[model samples]
Target: MNKYLTLLLLAAVMISCSKPSDIIEQRTFTVSLDTVQVDSKDEILFLNYFLGVSTLDPSQKFLYNLNVRENILEKINLETLSLDTLIQLEREGPNGIGSPFKIIALENGGFVFSNNYTLRYMDANRQVTKQTTLTREPYITDLLPSGKSLSVQSNGISNDGRYLAGLYETSEMSDKPEGIVWFDLENNTGKLIQTQALDFIRENNLTLELEGQIRGGFSTAVFFEPSQDKILFSPTSRNMLMIYDLAADSLITKKYDSKLTSNEQKPGEAKTITDLNEFDKLREDLLKEVTFGEWELDSKTGYRWRFSKELDRTIGEDSLIFKTVVTAIDENFELLGEAQLPQDFVFPYSFWIRDGMPYVFLNIDDELAFVRLKPNFGND
Candidate 1:
């Protein structure tokens, strides 16, 4: 009877170990590209730096980009591929959203601007309707030790514009993110949620210090899915996806084994170099490792798409090309498909899926252009 019981336990362990292999099937996808040019009077400055598509627009037609150089909000029509309007923002005064470095489109055609210290909400008429200073928040301030404050970014805003999800760092130089804070915009209340899942970011960071100044390292990024009330915490060094459900107030971590690339990158060691050339060489070597991008959810197909890339060492570091691959996951967090992008395409800071098609920012000889990737999932 004891032998039979031992056999049953072994069978259970084997079944659990083999479940992922049996259930997760590899899929292939064919990708085609189309480039659309943006017709503009003046050259759009920092077009790819920080930009977002209008969530208020059901068709996802408008792309809102913040020109940090000019402090202007450039709204481009994605459907027509034209510059619709540019609203110049003031640096000071009543309607001023002070030195906003990040812009997020709200559900009600409004915008949330973050300057790393304060989050200001602007209405359609360009009026600053609401504002929250992160340093003043007791919930956030109390968490930190003396002489340390939180540097907040507008990571995600809720569908109804009631809650703002912020990713905060301990200091300006800190590459590690402490945790996420969910601020109730209407009530002016906040809740801090910290988890061990984000520890990988600190563990895997490759920091370069020169003359007592930290130079380079990767940071944590967050993606908010309004439809599902989920906040995805993605670290650049690892292939792990951590999802925070607002409704349930729970965090779920998902790790995948990719048949195409390495599952995770090895943690890099911190180095202090005196010469600039040595710093560049070390940075280039670090870039050759697998790094994962933010996961973007496709409303049309209910699938999530994430792009990962490793440096193509064949090309010079000056050229900076990567061997890019896009992986698709279904609604159930199961791996759906993956495809290696064409060599001509570069990894983009601005990318989104419209009608189940992926669009990436492209610069065509100083002009604004976008490359639309039409992916054909063979089974679908």
Candidate 2:
């Protein structure tokens, strides 16, 4: 080998390994958004941490262009997944500093999202159908107790278009929340209901002095059951699910052992038990809407779900069931697949159905691919 050639090869190798973001995996084809710039008139809906992306504008209604130019929210041409038109609400971005998290369409054909600043309920006309401040900053990712519970949320709306679920947070050291409140969109009301979490301190590892329980903070995102009566929500940095009964005006806290990737956890974490009970409860709740549903959970496999409900809300439960397992699968409740993920494979929202399977979005990888799954029996 010539001296010149050796030096050149060494330099090439060094440059190739220099930047981690440049690392690429051939298997992943998930769309990588380039942050199509936004201006005063146009709005761009993009994934913050590998979150989903879309762009919508009012002008789209007046003029038709399959080819998007200077418009956000209007960029879904690859498939039939409808691109929602957010009307009425003024244009905004995530947490008001950057773009918000993912955007999801709703059951009645509208859209829902938190501005990272406040919750918004927009019509298909790109108008502010309704709006309220859900959280201050660092919005908690949540969904409606029922209807379309996307990762993001809007501050307004009930089944009757009257009540709205808003985000609330106090200092981690503030008093443990003794009351919960929500914005009422129908009559334009803000109602605060008393609530509590299941061992708010022990589950969180925070000090709850006799003075008051210190809350980490209020997250805008909370999960809602399919009935639109209950919500499943999480606080910051915790995988535990908090069930809020809206109609009953009560709250229950249940902690699932957080599902950490092999990379995220300390050594031997996988061998340790990961909570699957909360998933079981969610399955029971999901089944009431879907009927005769089934769910199973394995520590390595995560969670499961399959909807026996013919057609009530059509929140895309069928799509999620197959997706949860495509990443990994279990046989007869046993586990398979590696939890260690690529650095870029940022985890997205996930849950399991009891008789069904676990589903997750691996955006940490460059491209986003929806995993659909079927399982084989264990101990064959």
How many pairs collide in each candidate, listed in order? 0, 62
Residue 85 in candidate 2, Cα distance off native in Å = 12
lDDT (Cα) of model 2? 0.32
Candidate that scores best on TM-score:
1
Cα deviation of 166, candidate 1, in Å = 5.4
How many residue pairs in model 2 have overlapping backbones? 62
Task: Quote each prediction's TM-score.
Answer: 0.78, 0.39
Flag regions of model 2 displaced more than 4 Å: 1-48, 52-71, 74-99, 107-109, 133-174, 198-228, 234-346, 349-368, 374-380
- Tens digits of per-residue lDDT for model 2 on 274-363? 234543443333233211112223324343322111122335554322111122222322112212222222234442221232323233
RMSD of each: 9.7, 19.0
C-alpha displacement of 107 in model 2, angstroms? 4.2
